[model samples]
Target: MSGDDKYILVAQIGGAFGVKGEVKITAYTADAQALKAYSPLLDAKGQPALTIISARPDKHGLVAKVKELATKEEADAARGRKLYIHRDQLPEPDEDEFYLTDLVGLEGRDADDKVIGKVKSVQNFGADDMLEITPAEGGPTWYLPFTKAATPEIKPAEGWLRIIRPVETSERDAD
Candidate 1:
């Protein structure tokens, strides 16, 4: 991995919230409220771009006031800007629990040790987490549930994981 890719994206400025320079931040961290705790969030260039002065939960997301921005115009200018931090800044995950950043790009192998694909994205569309995998040969992506039954092992250090194929339960398959 390149030095620039070592940083993990922690949050993103969704948009300006109010007349004040507070922006709505969609946090990607484990704890959304902890976004403030990781102050001096960096930009993709690794520069300390934003410092959270205060953050509070709003209806949509966490409303945050940066150290210098003091007006809606200032915050609006930063909309869609992603906030990042060096990987070292984050605490290591517990056993069996890996950070989403660590899981992305990992080679996914089936129970027989056959490489199925590489992890493209990890998404949570309300129900639960899903892993979008792009096949090694280049085809349309398929999704696998981020559950124990589907993903029994994750070895980020080895850059791979074991996937248990889900059983087919459709009516056609039941015939």
Candidate 2:
């Protein structure tokens, strides 16, 4: 399949482990360890492909050795390089479940049919998912919660999302 046909993304890569060219990986898959099974990871440009020789748990990620990398220096050079697999390699998720990548480029709108912005990206900083929307006319980007109440409709086919505006509260009534 062509590179564009692939939907997988490189999650994370670790620094060189030992002189034998072993590195670490942190996959975003539900079963992180299963990433090694996907083997033959592609680079961002889809030029170089890497094969996982062995992968085992080490601290927060899985330590792995890739074919063709026979020295610590080579492994160190690959540090921070993301490994990508074909999107088809991943199992299908149930309906109502969406990947963050699928949300990108989706249109954002309010209840009154007014255009709000376009989804640039989705960010998660521990608590909840945040939708980063960039306005059409160069306005400041807005971060809105991607909750059921805030985002009632998400039509991926239409590439649009309907969001409810947040209600602001005044502090004066607290006194």
Candidate with maximal TM-score: 2
- Compared with the true structure, the alpha-carbon lDDT of candidate 1 equals 0.84
Q: What is the lDDT of residue 2 in candidate 1?
A: 53
Give me the runs in candidate 1 sitting further than 4 Å from their true place: 1-4, 57-61, 167-175
lDDT over C-alpha atoms for residue 112 of model 2: 86
lDDT of 2 by residue, 37-90 (tens): 777777776654678888888765678887957788987777788877766777
lDDT of 2: 0.78
lDDT of 1 by residue, 1-175 (tens): 2565578888888878889678889888768787777789888788888898888886555888888577899888888998888888789878766788788999999878999899998988999999999998898998999998899888998999888767667955888
Backbone N/Cα/C clashes per model: 0, 0
